[model samples]
Target: MLVYVVATALAVLFTYISVVYDKTLKDSLQKSRYVYLKPRIDVWQKLTLYVLRVASVLPLVLVAGFRYKVGTDWGNYLRSFRSVTHGKDGHYGEKGYRFIQKFVAFFTSNYIWLFLLCAIIFAGFYFVGIYKMSINPPLSVALIVATSIYFSFLNGMRQGLAQAILFFSLRYVFKRDWKRFLIFVLLASSFHKSSLVFLIVYILYGFKIDIKRIIFYIVIFGMVGLAGGQLVKYVVMKTKYAHYYMSAFADGGFEWLWFFISTAILVVMCCYYENGQKSELKGQFNVLLWMQMISVIFCLISATVPESNRIVWMFNIGQILSLPILISLEKDKRWRLVLLVLILGFYMLATYIAIRGGSHRVLPYRMSFGGE
Candidate 1:
């Protein structure tokens, strides 16, 4: 528990420092005396910014990379890594993940290399994703920790990689780069077939949410949810995800916690609605709104078709990303601070519950190579 606490604190602190550095550098460079030296100063600023950003992400990468028997699937992943290293057909994970396992095994039979590489991939994509798409990157990074999404990366390695890739692909979605977006979706799907669901975002990205459309989506998805279990069973049976049908996930149940959290964020956004907001801000908010709505739909489906909850994660980025945008839109400074504290406090409490729950088995953090 102390391990997680310290890692979270360090990640948040370093991220805050990076944010401060950016602001301070920008302000300092705007002076008339710095005009002649702008080129040199700009180069230095870019280098320093890169370093700070890397520092902000290093704690998370190190903690995740150095773990041993930590994540719930630690043993399972090790078996698969060893199988690949021995020139056997890896049977545990997605083909893309297996391919990477084989590629790594070609160089070293040690499984720690695979773990470290996966940690780097997860951290790199997450940091770069939030950095590119988030208005408040620090808040977004903190939310990732406080909401226990970071732990998910430690457990669901392949799905985590897919999610991170899809998260980064959002920038292309906002830019309306169809070719790039499709490419990324295909890339993510190679790691986890569930990520293919993200392709719908491309088509629905332009939706301007209104009461009528909201009601329509609710009705449509609600009906789908009613038949969710059977529907998912049939669809997954046709794909590599067929095994989920026999797993604990097939017993459908609503994710009340996720429902509440996602709905709360959407409601908060609606409460703080501003018609006079900047076009760029509005655009970003609108895209995230659709992402949030997708989360809501899957949450509804998961109630009766629990396996669909996996799909929920692919779209849940909006739940965290939307909060900072709302905060930025707030006119009252004190109220803004209040909102920030409430959201952060709520998620921090969530982190305690999630860690204590032990679903991911990430506590009692132990290092690899048989160290405590």
Candidate 2:
């Protein structure tokens, strides 16, 4: 109940702020539009558009509030604490995250209290993304968070506050500030080591893609596959419940293929767009697209070839940035609505199938939100 209240309050506050702030910002855009080739959209019309954008954020809150998936994430959260606290600097040595779990455990070892706290933490992350967007079109941030598997998996992913921090880092990256990106990535690594991979983004986003860099990326991918076996072995032995490694990710074969297809499409979007259009969207798409592409490539080729589906979570790295890029670029309203429905439906179906596959699995405490 407290979770619902907090989520509701944040949603209302974000929507109100976005609507109120846009008048000044849109005036600049309207001036540019007139200076360019187009007639200015009137102030009244722009304000109405602002209201609609603000209004759009509400549904996401409603949906996430209605069916917050609180399963496996909760378990991961407890283990995160155990990894950091119970043993010798174990979290760092383990190569996986155990930091936030330890922090939460400090307050109350009780699972119920821990869950409410986690929900609050994730909601805070969700809003931070919205707050960052208040300077521009804010609906984009809210919509992306609302539709993301990242948001859905907050229970598991919330172990160390990576999503919240990552969103803030993304805000910086969108602004073209490499320094802030470095700072956020460093901070994120303190919580989860896997986040270190995010720092490599400059290698992709920093320089113009030369033929050599492409070759380097290819070589890196191959090395990841070759090194994957040793790395997985190390994490499994060092980390708790490591045997969960043997269970194959259910989305391995065909579902796995779709991931590559998604990456290919985004790359094509980059290539097909004019240099100016690409420049406009690059603010959001460049880092995210490469991150998802690299993440999928790594998961697909790992030579150890054990049942290491955990790597798939890396794909959600693209969701926050990609949604807004697609929304902002898509010119046709009907087509935009179609894509929105398709994206939402795809996640709904995918999530339902995944949860159903694990239906027989039992939780220590079933705080159901009708996801069964």
Q: For each candidate, what TM-score against the reference?
A: 0.91, 0.62
- lDDT of model 2 at residue 95? 31
Q: In model 1, which residue pairs have backbone atoms overlapping below 3 Å? A: none
RMSD in angstroms, candidate 2?
Answer: 7.9
- In terms of lDDT, the poorest run of 10 residues in model 1 is 271-280
Residues 259-280, candidate 1: write the lDDT tens digits: 7777787667666555413546
lDDT tens string, model 2, 1-372?
344334434555566665565565667767888678554567787677656544545543443434333444444544545454454343332232344445555765544444454445544555556555533334444344333343444434433355556666776666778898888777766655666666666556664443235436756875776567567667676776465455553223433533544454455445434442465565456566566556556555543544333344444545655654565566789976776666555654554455446521211222434312
Top candidate, metric lDDT:
1
Whole-model lDDT values for every prediction: 0.78, 0.51
Mark the regions of model 1 whose C-alpha exceeds 4 Å error after superposition: 32-38, 42-45, 212-216, 275-279, 370-372
TM-score of 1: 0.91
